[model samples]
Each structure stands twice: as structure tokens, then as C-alpha cells.
Target: MIAKPLAKIRCLKSAQCLDETTEDQIDFEVDFVFPLTEFDLQFVGCEVINFTRKIIERSQPTPKQLIGLAHALHALECLPAITPGISVEYGLQLRKGDDEFAEFKYWSVSINEESFEVTSGGSVYDSSVGSDSYSGFKLYVEAGSYGYRECSDDSYGWIESTVEVLNLGGVLEVSDDSGRGCIKGTDE
Candidate 1:
């Protein structure tokens, strides 16, 4: 499942673009400060304030959350001029179990910026279908002549990152590191 931005957070705040009519500098910074507690985040709500003074819904966030948000926002800030119709794409190679020898299946692809959040508990797969199954999720950013072969299955295995936008370029390959079922693509 895709991670939801802190919608319940009430104290945290951020600043980014000045206006929708104006361009957002990639260098623009977004910051947040929230109380740290183990239980409040799980049961209570958190808040987020943006640059436009817009108070957005944010859930209890961790330090990792801040880092992920910063990375995604920074990448999107550095957009260059492109053809009007050009699009960005993302992909993932996912499988069950920690060991490479374990049963492996499923792949996920997305172009929506919201699909790159890195939070956990998004239901990457149906736990009931397979017991003792583990899966790893990866994010890819691609652009230009570089793209993955079109896939017909949108019912992908899982999505690992939701807050971070992917950069779609260079190579799109995934390996178990054990040399099992490694997939790679090179842009001509």
C-alpha cells in the first residue's frame, strides 16, 4: 500500500512553493518539527504546515519520514524544461521472503509522484495467501529514451516508497544480490 502523508499531524509545519502560479525552486526547503513519542503517533494525530501557510493533514511522523519527504521534494524541485507531453515513470521488482532461494514473484510500476513513499505497513502483498513470506520493495526513477517495457499487470506485488518521487533514467534492474533472477535494462 502507498504510505499516506501525515494527515493527522497538527503541530508539524513545512514551507515550499510560494504559489501555484509561480515556479518552485528545487533548492526551496521544507521543514517540520514535531514532538517525539512512541505512542502519540500511533493513536493520536499530527499536523503539517506548508510554505503557502496551508495546514495539511499529517500523521505522527518519524525522523525517517522527514528524510524521505526532503528527498522527494528536492528531486521534484529540480525539474528541467521538457516537451509538453513527456512523462516520468517508476518501477519495482518485488518478491517474497528474505532468502533469494525463496519463492519470488510480482513486479510493480507507477508514474504518479504519490506512488513513491517509503513507509511500511502498506500491505505490499496478501499475508494470508502465503505464510512466512518476506518481500523487498525498491524505487526507480526513469526519463527520456529510458523506459521499462510496457506491463499489462497493474496488480503489482508491493510499493515501498510513497513520499519519494522516483528518477526515471539510466538503468532499471533489480538483483537479489544472490544472483537469482536478476533483471536489468540498458537505455540505448
Candidate 2:
């Protein structure tokens, strides 16, 4: 068993927007090679947000981000090395989109009843969906995607998108808009 990477939030957080219009966010996304390629689990990507501010990087990641990354890496690591994209093997199930096909390179870490699963093909999972328990926490890892809203308290907030947790070819590397931040799977 591997200890989850130590990722504690670096800033003060609130349960609700406190007069401030901006709130930080974190998202999780995992990428696999076309679905059923035979290979070993490479890495899990995680990211943090400071509302377009220069504050997140591989050195400092939030637990909300790390936890989801940990779980995703854990589940997929259980999968035996296969040569195809996503195949029906063991408990691993391949689900396709309902209407048409879309090019979604990453899968969202969906949580239900406190458990998590890697899924895509809908709304491209992000922060707003399961952000109740995650302070400044969001996962969809859609690069450069954010959702803005007026909080009930009248303050505004910026919800950041996903963090790609699994990449088959190599680590899914990402950078913030400022180009000063990056998200990677390794603690180093």
C-alpha cells in the first residue's frame, strides 16, 4: 500500500463565499491510452487553483485533489495490463456516450455515496458537480475550463476544472494560464 502524497491546502478556505467574488478550485482528470492498451499505470495528475492567481503547482497540491488522484490511481492500478483501449475485463466496464461520440481525453472521478469511479461521456465532470465536501475542490480536469456563478451570498466564484490522473503514454502534464504552475503525478 502506498501512502497518498501529502497535499495540504496552502490557503485559508471558507464553507461559503465571504464577500469575496473569487474562490479557489481543484479538479481531477485521468487519461488512458485510447482505452484498452496493454501497459502499466503511469501516473495520476492533480491540480489546484488560485482564481487565475499564481499559487498552485506540483510542489503544493490540495488533499481534495490528492484524495481523488489517490483513489483513481488505486482503482485503475487494479486493472491487468491489456492491449486494447477500455475492454470488459474483471470489474472494469467500458461505457460509451448515449447520443453521439465525443473526443474526451480524460475521465472524471465521479463520486456517489462517498465512493469514486472513473467515468466520462457526460458534461465532462468538473468542480461544481461534487464540490460540496471539497473546499476549493473540483475535478473534471478540462484544461482551461471554469464555471462562474453568483453565490447565494451575492459573492461570485470561479470553479476550476479537472486534473488528469491517469496517462498511458506518459504523465499528463498541465500548466496554469500564467505558465507558472504545473500538475504532475509524482511527489517529486
lDDT of each: 0.23, 0.22
Ten-residue region with minimum lDDT total, candidate 2: 82-91
Q: What's the distance in Å from true for residue 129, model 1?
A: 7.6
Determine the C-alpha RMSD for candidate 1 after optimal superposition of all C-alphas: 16.7
TM-score of each: 0.22, 0.19
Which candidate comes out best when scored by lDDT?
Answer: 1
| Candidate 2 Cα deviation (angstroms), residue 85 | 22
Question: In candidate 2, what are the lDDT values of residues 9-91, reduced to their tens digit?
Answer: 11112102112222344221111111211111122222111211121232243554343334333333332111111111111
* Residue lDDT tens for model 1, 1-188: 11113411221122221112123332221121122222212211211112101100122224443333333223233221111111222222224444323333333222222121111122233345543433344333222222222212221322212212122111222111111111112110
Off by over 4 Å in 1: 1-56, 77-141, 149-188
Instruction: In angstroms, give how far residue 170 of model 1 lies from its true place.
Output: 32
Error of 1 at 121 (Å): 11
Q: lDDT of model 1 at residue 121?
A: 24
Error of 1 at 106 (Å): 13
lDDT of 2: 0.22
